[model samples]
Target: MKILFVCLGNICRSPVLEAVLRAHAEKAGLDWEIASCGTGDWHLGHGADPRSRASAQRRGYSLAAHRARQLCAADFRRYDWLLAADRSNLAEIVRRRPADATARVALALAHAGLPQPLDVPDPYYGNAEGFEAVVDLAEAIARAIVARDAE
Candidate 1:
């Protein structure tokens, strides 16, 4: 299975999720391919935010190699699933969908059973605690994906 995680800028939440889910899938022995992208092009090719990288490292998930990229039409055809970080991102991705694309798109948290529809708040403008919270939420959702894939 191929899964793509999406967020606004791809520097914080999405990259963290990509690492977390990839690690879990590997440990579970699942043949899953994971990648992350952003709805916006502002941070393309940039590494994840420093705070986000630090927070993920604290939990043993490395975001060092992740580079932000914008979501493209090819993504819809390449991935089996496109998981958005929040509703806004979700909507943005949906708006970009090609008429012939068949990939399934949904909120990443919701796919993980999170009840909220809002996007994971951006931690860029916030403090370390905010980045930690983003990690916490991403970890929870990644575990949930692992569990679902196991079943």
Candidate 2:
């Protein structure tokens, strides 16, 4: 299976999710493909935000190889699932999604079985603790996805 994570910009949240999920899936012996992108063109081709990288690395998940990319038409059909970091990104993705697209889309937190307030908060403008929260959340989500896939 293939999965794609989406956020406002590719440099922060989505990259963290991508790396965490990949590590979890690998550890669980799942062969799923994972990637991330943004709804906006900003930061395209740039490396993941430094704070996100550092935060994830502290948790033993590496964002070292992540590069920012914008959501493209092809992504819809390329991934088996397209997960949004929050409601707004989810809305934008659904709005921009092609009618013929084949991917299933949902909020990442919700898909991971988290309760209401299903959005994964953006940590780009926040303090170090915020990035840390994102990493924490990423680990939880990675385990959840791995669990679901295992079943």
Candidate 3:
């Protein structure tokens, strides 16, 4: 499976999700392709946020090689899944979706079976605790994705 995680700026949530999910996918011995990008280009070519990197590092996931990029039209056809961090970004992704695009787009949290108001809350403006929370959600979503693939 090929997957892409999307966020507003690509420095926090999406990259975290990409790393966590990549680790989980590897552990499950799945030959999956995974990547991440932002709906906005503000952080393009920048590394993952320090806080996000530190959080994932503590959990044994590396964000060292992550570089932010903006979502492009080609992404719609390249990934099997295009997961958004929140509703706003998801809306942007949907609006940019091409008619022939094949990716299954959805909120990362809801796709993980989380309840209403599904969103992988942005940790940009928050503190360490917020980044930690993103890690928690990333792990859960990663596990869920692995399980679903197993099925």
- The most accurate candidate by TM-score is 2
For model 2, the stretches where C-alpha displacement exceeds 4 angstroms are none
Q: Write the per-residue lDDT of candidate 3 for residues 1-151, one digit (tens) a residue.
A: 8999999999999999999999999999898999999999888899999999999999999999999999998999999999999999999999999999999999998887775548888889988999999999999999988998767
Runs off by more than 4 Å, candidate 1: none
What is the alpha-carbon lDDT of model 2 when measured against the actual structure?
0.92
Estimate, for each residue in 49-105, the C-alpha lDDT of model 2 and write its tens digit.
Answer: 999999988989888788899999999999999999999999999999998899999
| lDDT tens digits by residue: candidate 1, 117-143 | 456777888899989988888878888
* Model 1 whole-model lDDT (C-alpha atoms): 0.90
Q: Candidate 1, TM-score vs. the true structure?
A: 0.96
Order candidates by TM-score, high to low: 2, 3, 1
What does the lDDT read for residue 12 in candidate 3? 96
lDDT of every predicted structure (CA atoms): 0.90, 0.92, 0.93
* Model 3 stretches with alpha carbons more than 4 Å out: none
Clashes of 3: 0
How well does candidate 1 score on lDDT at residue 98?
Answer: 98
